[model samples]
Every structure is written in C-alpha cells, then in structure tokens.
Target: MSQQIPFVDYLVLGENPHLVANECAACGARFFDRRNACAACGATGFRKAQVATAGEVRAFTIVTVAAPGVPVPFVAATIDCEGTSVKANLVKVTPDPEHVKLGMKVRLATHSLGTDSAGTEAIGFGFEPLETAIDGQ
Candidate 1:
C-alpha cells in the first residue's frame, strides 16, 4: 500500500479528508492553527473542531506568477466554511474572474501533490466549484 502524508498539520486524510481548526470553547472563535489563548475572550480552553467541507468564496485574486513550475492564473480565495474563513486554492475550472466569482459555492477537494520514489504520496487540499455554480447564480 502506498503511504500518505498530509500537506499540512491540520489536514486529516483518509476516506473523508477534512480540515480541523482550533475552536475556542469560550467565545466559539475558530482558528486554523493552534492558539495559546482565545483571541476573542482570552480563554485558554479549546477543542479540535471539524470544519465543514462546503463554503462560499468571500474574496479571491488571480495569481499570474508563482514559484518555478507552478501554474499561473490560479484563483486564490478566502472561503467562509460555516463561520470560519479559510484560505485555499480554487480548482476544477478556469482560473478567471468570469468563472471564479465572489460568493461562489465550493466544496473541499483533495489531490495527491506527488509521490516519492519510496512509494509515499503527499496529499494536498483545495476548494472546487460545486453544483451551485452550474446556473451561474
């Protein structure tokens, strides 16, 4: 069996790959990373919270340049998953303003970044346009 590893620490991979966030128990504020204390309430209590896979694009930008070999014109967006905002790349469609729009519905999608000669695969996650975009509403 090929071994798999997450691209980031908060990403959980398996049959249902999902992202986890640190949710402040006191104020219910969520953060993508571990926090020393709640930014809203200054509470030290927190819990591992599973974020919803579906979200709406709040903002986005078209990238025309990136590191070597990386594709250009990709849509980098800030998505609101439930209540938490997540920054991720938008995939599965043309990366343009006409196609990728603000408030577009999207779903979490995962892909294999690449594999090593040792048969280990690196997993990556992104958001893709969902059925809600079909009518272009």
Candidate 2:
C-alpha cells in the first residue's frame, strides 16, 4: 500500500487530521511558516501549537476567474480558527453567495488531490460548512 502525504507541511494526515503552527512563545502569535522572530512582538522564541479545526467564515469571495487549468467559481475565504486567521478555500458546498456567508460555522476537511508515480497520494485541506460536517457529508 502506498502512503498518503499532506500537501502542506503543517497538515497532519492520519485518522484525525489537523494543522499545527509555530507560535511565538512570548506574544502567543501563531504562524504557519517558519519565523526567526515574532512579527507582532519581535519575540525570538516559538513553539508548536495545534490549530483549531472548527472555525467561522470571517470573509469570502466568489472567484470567477483564474489561471488556465484552474477551476473558477470557487469560494476563497478567510476563516477565524479560535482567533487565528486562516486563508483557505472553502469546499464541499456550492460557491454561491446564497450558500456561503460571513460568520458561517465550518470545520476542517481533507481531500485527495492526486497520486504520484510512486503511488503516494497528496492530501489537501479545506473548510466545509458545519452542518455538512455534522451530518457526515
């Protein structure tokens, strides 16, 4: 059997998938990328912190145009995951104004992007509506 890998380094792919961030030890600011110093407080220390899987949609936009080969009419959103702002695509729902709204509750979800020649699948993460997640959809 081939192994599955996360598309991003912070995504932990397993029975329970979640994201981790580098948190500033002094200021408590979380960042997904490596940082030598805290941007908010100029702290030089950091620690691994688990990000909340559940979040609220703080803002979103319906993208109708994109680069060639990329799909259009997708929801690009900013989610507030326990006070941390996460920029990710919203999936498993129609990309329309009526369906997606600000302050909508969402939960992290993973999907298989594709497999490589070595048969390793790359998993990507997204946020789905809370209702859909609760219903096991």
Candidate 3:
C-alpha cells in the first residue's frame, strides 16, 4: 500500500481529508499556517481547529496565466466555511462565470498532487460544488 501525505501541514490527507487551522483563542481568528501571534489580536494563545467541510463561495477569480507546466483557467476562491473564510482552489467545475459564482455552495475535496518514487502519495485539498460532494468521486 502507498503512504499518503498532505501537500501542506494545514491539510490532512487520507480517506477523510480535511483542513486544520490554528485559531486564536482570544479573538477567534483562524490561520491556516503556524503562527506565533494572532494577526487579528496579537494573542499568543491558539487552538487547533478543524474547519468545516461545507462552505459558500464568498469571492473568486479565474486565472488565465500560471507558471510553466501549470494549468490555466482555474478558479481560485475565498469560501466562507462556518464563519471562517478559507482561500483555496475551486475544482471539478468549469472555470467560467456561468459555472462559478459568488454564494455558491462548496465542500472539501482532495486530489493527487503527485507521487514519490518511494510510493508515497502527496495529496492536496480544494473546494468543489457542494451538491456533488455527496457523490464523493
């Protein structure tokens, strides 16, 4: 069997992939990366918070340009998940205005980023259309 790992420390990849953020206990601000102090309130105290899988698109953009070997016309979005805004890629939908819109529901989804020669798989998470999330393809 292949070993599975997350693309980033904040993302937990496996059969049930989920995003974990550090929350400021003082101000209730959530951060995706490790932090010494809270940006919102400068509090040093924090707690690990598992963000909601479902969200609504608060903002987005269709990128037409990217680095070499990177695909273009991908949707990058800010999703409001249980009051926390998470910035991630919007996948499994056409990258068009008609397909992607603000206030559209979405849910966490995982994809294979690549595999190491040692048979370890690196996976990343993104938000996909919520209605189809139940199918879990």
Best by TM-score: 2
For candidate 2, write residues 1-137 as lDDT tens digits.
99999999999988889999999999899999999899999989999999999999999999999999999889999999998888999998899989999999999999999999999999999999999988987
Indicate the residue-level lDDT of 36 in model 1. 97
Candidate 2 Cα outliers beyond 4 Å, as residue runs: none
Query: Which has the better lDDT: candidate 1, or candidate 2?
Result: 2
Give the Å error, residue 21, model 2: 0.6
TM-score of candidate 1 relative to the true fold: 0.91
RMSD per model, one decimal: 2.8, 0.7, 1.4
Ranking by TM-score: 2, 3, 1
- lDDT per residue for candidate 3 within 4-49, as digits (tens), equals 8888898876566788899999999999878999999999999999
TM-score to true structure, per model? 0.91, 0.97, 0.94
1-137, model 1: which lDDT tens digit per residue? 88999989899988888999999999999998779999889999999999999999999999999999997879889999999899999878688778888889999988899999999999999998997345453
Candidate 1 clashes between residue pairs 3 or more apart in a chain or in different chains: none
- Between candidates 2 and 3, name the one with more favorable TM-score: 2
